[model samples]
Target: MHTCAPPVETLEELLEAHPSINGNFGHLLLLQKDADDGTLSQALRPYFESAHLDARQAFHADIGIDLHPDAGDGDGPAVTYPGCLPLTTRKGLFGEVLAGLVTEGYPLVGEHEWCVPIFLFRYHEDARNYLFSLARRPERRRQTVGRLGSDFIGLLLDENGAVIRFIAGEAKWRKTLNQSAVDTVMLGDLIDDPAGGGARVRSGKGVWNDLNNDPPVPIGVRQLQRLLQEYDPDGYDAAILSLERALVVREPVPLPRTDLVIVAGNASATRDTLTCFLPFEGTPPEYTAGHDLQLVEVVLKKGEALIDAIYDSLWSENADA
Candidate 1:
């Protein structure tokens, strides 16, 4: 039986309510309230042993993380620091705060909760290496989409034309990734044979590996194009645009079998529209610089720009369509 959780407004409140999440760790959430424009600066505070609030404040100011959004969301007012005090009238501080938490080794738990980031100290370089190793491959039509419910991992190709490997991970710094979470990401890509010997149909006769009788089939972008033309002809342009955006962003091309897209930090989404469509799997939290964080950010920003441009160009082309 699953136990229902309560809805808490503040980060601190959530930590207090669910201690077992993300390894039973507690966190210190910090925010600076600016009296002038009412903007706020927010980050997680390091634990303090002393009872004095001033001591905690002094320590936190000395060492704290800054929240950075993935890409600029158009023009807006400036957000301040310390109390996350208002320097601009833009209400974007919350998004930045969540982004900061993701960078500081925290994962958004669900639609509302985030994993607690306590005792998760990083020496920076190690964390950077991890981030860089999580590098994503550019999306291509030459690759294969797993199935209806496979875990969405980005593919990386070697110098050769063949795919070498891919990247997929779960950030449970706050909560443990159970079997369900694991299955959610990997269930769709079910190949009948892990070894290249035979083809096992989902509910039919299993066949022996007969390369002479049945030549090894190569799946490529032409197949993908055909699939789009047949099933999602209306979204053919969008699909092509999305594929190009993924390539420009250096992200993996998502499977077309389902309505999910893998965005930053291995997060996934099911939105149908273009802009609102998330580019990865998992919750939509801002990811921080690990190792290749900067590179990933550059690719993501470029991809977003490319997608927007494509939509504009297509909109004009389809003025009559």
Candidate 2:
């Protein structure tokens, strides 16, 4: 699997999509700006603590550690928070669900290790590209090591819930996932495949290195075509499949849901585009357009049973909305 972050600017947009967040939570770890801080926990502590209530909280939350680049030219810390769950176990009500999304057929786009939002479409930074490579730049380090800037950092899992990828995506979101977006996702997947995303993240042309020298095919154009052929026979389905494939591989699970649906992107594509091509859990999609966004609802037959245990735990603990 792979990993990436949501754009910084769109955090509000995402929060708005959720009923839980009547407005932004000051307790949430919103990026204060880019810096080369090495302590991801420091940046996230406030949010975690705000969400934490008692001892059993540990059962719901887990912490992870790793490293990334410095703010500018050096190295920094690579830390992770299972924000609410550990990456190693699948014992809780949501545990199997997290594992299944990571291990199975769908893409896990916009999900972080601790289940924080890591979708690339939530941020507004430009995708980093250099003359020789195509990868995002790591952050610069600050004198005092603490927290990461974006929520995209985390662990990724394969279909069996095995960690396959880990990364810190740039804080750039896209409104239109046109050719550039497709190319970006495809290239990221290729470079981060056999070799992890760490080596090439700061290097330009990591994936595009051979583009100028190799057989004149655009770096990921061919692979994109092949992926589309297999997962998407029709054009619209191809688009949804592309997005789904990228997200699932990166984060290794379906994105965290706000009221049971992934409401993150501002893509102009229709609900039918997603249902027709990249359907999940066997639910047919139904759409409702609001002034701010489009709402696509899918009815799951076993929905109540599947989430009953999870919700029951929440009720038992007196969890908040």
Candidate 3:
């Protein structure tokens, strides 16, 4: 017999109330019911479309990386609307979730103020392909580019609007919820320690490093710093100081950084998946870096098919109309 967990009205509440196995870390288990005959997608259609467009705009505004140059030319984003292409819709959904997490103030390493959905900006190749197709660049079609860093990187701020932490997050949508799968998804993209010590390090050299460092900064971090400088000079100074201190610190002191892992899959609600799945045994050494690590597991009854069904329903409803 399947035990019925408490019903949650919103995703934010679901994540917030999720049970954490480790007292030191946060974990959430979300078991989403199948969509209600297209009603849920219908209600969320506007938000999804808006989130896609807004995420694109934010990327352009912050990093000057415009996937669709003629997006807002009144021609409608170089893609179909009300029935966005599957990949475009997927990107939008991820961005929407990130925006929701930011708005809901999910705990991170700092006092958590605000966040920008910078993930899609880095990993979205479908938009680029669409634009390339429009430009008649067929040779570049379907060419996959490697991801530079984490799936999602949010610039977390303090109450004073000062940049306090950089939250690097990874989101995986799959049908499996086993231990190997969970660990692979969580620690796969993180920088591996060179000492062969089997330690997965969060902050390190290259793109994963602190933002306020000197020249040759990563494009995304550089854009964030520029945004702070343009909007809040004082906040910019704070970010610079934080970065400088990060470089000077020899030992692991409290720093503004976090690694968030989000896994969505199919699982039994009553089963104890946390202890078996995550690597959060007594006093995990991974958390010794003074950076917060959070894991959120979103369990869906229908698993991976849930999203495909919702999209199909959305398109079918639009077609019937």
Candidate 4:
């Protein structure tokens, strides 16, 4: 369990105070409170840009690779510019925002000491280019990779550096938050149980398999593995034991995992802006079974336009040049 108290007394206070875009897993009402004329954009721009840089570095670092300059001048490699607002860019931004929220101390899980969010994989053309150019993985050039896992994977750790749980996240930004939208964000059969005797015996393209297995673990998972091996090898064994014990604990045993859902859209009509509500209220039992869930809803006054506006403002210079 978290030993630290939350920074804000109430969810409303959290929405009003911090640059909410930079944080994770809570209700956020944009352009509603804090009546300052230009505060929102000013606060979000720097965080977004920095996060973009950090994400690129982290992704490369995960695969034991380094990025070289497109045109080196000897000072160092020039930053790789994501020149336009692609779908991947938007998805990456959402992951970074969620990570910021976790780093800023929003509890994504009830019984974990802290959650560290990582955005180390990309499933788009830009990432493919980076992988091929740097690692020489020509096979990955035309083949789709990195799409089989969660967008943001959070390492839920206890104070002793033992990973107690994992949070696999999926973020969606749309004008509507309806049933179809929720289904889409949930990633169809990816959330299904592999052992549950169905046509799909294999785990679909999702984080569940990655979290349960070794060798191919995500960057965040590897970090925890290293932490355990370095600090407490016994704790590592105990963690695995805990998971194994869950098999016989009950009929529907819960995995040491959580699902993080981030949904952003307009919500100006209702006065209740920062309330904790389940976005996947009517999701299928198979989709949500055996996992704890955390949801953060970002209600923008401008709705879907808010995302495009932020992207344009952040990338306009590069695009124009």
The per-candidate count of clashes, in order, stands at 34, 44, 0, 2
Sort the predicted structures by TM-score, highest score first.
Answer: 3, 4, 2, 1
Candidate 1 global CA lDDT score: 0.23
TM-scores, each model vs. reference? 0.18, 0.19, 0.57, 0.52
- What overall lDDT, based on C-alpha atoms, would model 4 receive against the true structure? 0.44
lDDT of 4 by residue, 151-234 (tens): 555555565544466665655565544544444444334444655755443233332333234222334444334434444566
Model 1 spans > 4 angstroms off = 1-7, 10-117, 128-192, 195-321
Return the clash pairs for model 3, or none.
none
Candidate 2, residues 209-237: lDDT per residue as tens digits?
22222221121222323433443356334
Per-residue error at 247 for model 4, in Å? 17
Residue 3 displacement in candidate 2 (angstroms): 21
- TM-score of predicted model 2? 0.19
In the range 203-288, model 1's lDDT, one tens digit per residue, is 21111111112211112233333333444556345544443443343455542210111222111233122222111232222321
Please write out the lDDT profile of model 3 over residues 194-242, one tens digit for every residue: 7779887543332213222322223445444544455456635866455
Off by more than 4 A, model 2: 1-151, 155-172, 188-265, 269-272, 275-321
Ranking by lDDT: 3, 4, 2, 1
All models, RMSD in angstroms = 23.4, 20.6, 9.2, 9.8
Report how far off residue 29 is in candidate 4 (Å): 9.0
